[model samples]
Target: MPEPYEERTGRRQTGPFAGQTKSPTDRDGRAVTFEAGAKQPGYVPPLSDHLSPNQAHLGSTSAASQPSAEDYLQMGIDKHEKSQGDEELSESAHYFRKAAEGGSAAGCVFYGLALRHGWGVQRDEKQAFGWLEMGCATVMQKPSTDIVDLDRRQSLMPMGTQNKLSAEVIMAIYEVGNCFEHAWGVPGTKRNQPNHQMAAMYYRLGAEQGDRDNQEHLANLLSQGKYGLKKDMWEAAFWYRAAIDNGLSPIGLSWVYKVRLLANQIRAGWP
Candidate 1:
């Protein structure tokens, strides 16, 4: 005689898949056979008994039902800001990855941030640098149109679109400079740290493009003579003035005032 279900299967025969048997000759391979009147595991009760009409749409994957890239990005931001656990942070990172893959530079930067800090993903300096670089490259990769062609295209585009594009480009440039300045996602030891010369170069690039933050950063570096740059108070003052003109607030006010005072003294031959 066959053993009882508990003895043979090592489990109580009580659920939907219970009261089933396998062919003795091929017991290991054959599918289970349910006894007559036994409820199959795959059976589901009528939806009318459990789900309301409004809840019927709970599970869907329609094209129109999918979230847009911007929507994903906003969701990521919301989750990241309110995240109190690793799982929530990871979900935020997932949304950021989706947005980045959808070609959003801001998304790329945030994803890089997540990687760098290990907020929602593993800490990977190389990968973070790569994403940040890609974000900057995306902004700089405009079509090779001449100034006239560029102006013509810009004039044809809506004002909001043009402004949005410009903002993306500027933010990308500034962030790239920040990465270089702070050695973010770069590997180095105390004896051979991040190259300040490269940092200054990037800052100069952004500053020339009218980014006030980069202008202020470049001024700070020049004034300090750090990063292999020569000490040139005049040049530093020039950048400080440029930054001020571009709406960089009072951070450099003291430096500007002192530089102007020394300049006045030299001009009046007062040593």
Candidate 2:
């Protein structure tokens, strides 16, 4: 958690990311190199399905034998894109479900998306939450850095042999957090109540991975002292800057830094 070189050189590292700035360290003290993946392929694909939103999560196990979860996910993505009718969208969701059950974190995310949005599947948030959590947990067990460049980066040690983690994989994690953060905002059942702790945990996961949106949300929590996170202006500023580095506009980071400076000058005892 050393100060980012961005605070030193006063410039964003827009060139070769290797050796140009401080690499985050792994839990084992190994320096963590960034390797980010972007938006999931065929995300929010054309929607129309014959299945009722009440469909059950079954039969995916009986799917026509596939090689691996990646293949299932690819099939789902491709099918969704090529879906010619309602029944086809259901076919896409079926493949996504197959991939999810096959243990592809990305597959879990896509399946969850299908469930939540009623895209050729049951619009069931409860089921969606479960699948999404499964996907995020997979990533949690095997985290990756989130810094994109002209090309996809690599984390040879941590990621092991999994398919390259993508924003889609991380989306599963982030969406779970989103469910918790805005729960009560909708004024509905108990499910709507915001679970700050859950939100904070997932947000921090995505943020640490260098996801732009998650960094800002985690920073917002720190600044507001919500989500069981203690108020720490410095940490808030850090994440704000991280968000900007990942693609968020600099205006928000600038404001936070300015606020941190003012707080310090006023001797408000803020971190």
Candidate 3:
């Protein structure tokens, strides 16, 4: 009989790989001896290489998938309204700051409020004034010519132009007036001196823009003749009428009617 195969080959008789065949070629098919733990010559393409040009472009433009300024502002408002604790308020303020940075007027106003009141962030009245001023400028900086043009175009104007004065703009204007009236973030004495003239100016700005709330406040101020403003019953009646025309409810209407009647009487020399 022939010698045992394993003994002739000088190989182990048992154990792993003892009976395995060895190829003349290397592990990767090169005409060389196979070595343990050798580096492989494989390559992995980048993720972008696998995508089409259009897909790559879409991925590059992923910022378009992010929430818009208005979306962030709304989210902030929702969070603030529904918050039950300081942590939630902080989250709300964070979203408001993002929206403000992204150019939402309402976001600027609310961010200012947050800073002023320390609701979520530190109370920094000076910083709050800066944001409030920005919001005020955004609403009040529109050109008078734009208002005239919008009024003239009326039905022909684009929807955006027709609704240029959003609720946020109105609220910003009102808040700016409040800031002036109360000196909340203004530089002045520690006693918080009021800036009646500036308050009246902002209130007029909002009232002129068809904000019923501002119109009512302006009417009250004009009627009272306080806050450094001269008594002007005619102007007060005009604003009261405007407020009524802008959908004041029955309760509001009643108050406006009484004020308008009293203003008329005062103008007509009646006590």
> Estimated TM-score per prediction?
0.57, 0.58, 0.59
Q: Candidate 2 regions off by >4 Å? A: 1-66, 139-169, 184-189, 224-233, 260-271
Residues 216-256 of candidate 1 have per-residue lDDT tens digits of 77777667665445666777787888878876566626667
Query: Between which residue pairs do clashes occur in model 3?
Result: none
Candidate 2 clashes between residue pairs 3 or more apart in a chain or in different chains:
53-122, 183-192, 184-192
TM-score of model 1 (CA atoms): 0.57
Query: Candidate 3: minimum summed lDDT over ten consecutive residues — where?
Result: 11-20
lDDT (Cα atoms) of all candidates against the true structure: 0.55, 0.57, 0.57
* Superior candidate under lDDT, 1 versus 2: 2
lDDT of 2 by residue, 60-166 (tens): 33345645777787778777767655566688889899888888876887787666656577566778777877876644543322224201532211345444445
Better of 1 and 3 by TM-score: 3
TM-score of 3: 0.59
| Each prediction's number of clashing residue pairs | 0, 3, 0
Q: Which stretches of candidate 1 lie over 4 Å from their true place?
A: 1-65, 139-165, 187-192, 245-252, 257-271
Better of 2 and 3 by TM-score: 3
Positional deviation of residue 270's Cα in model 3 after best superposition, in angstroms? 14
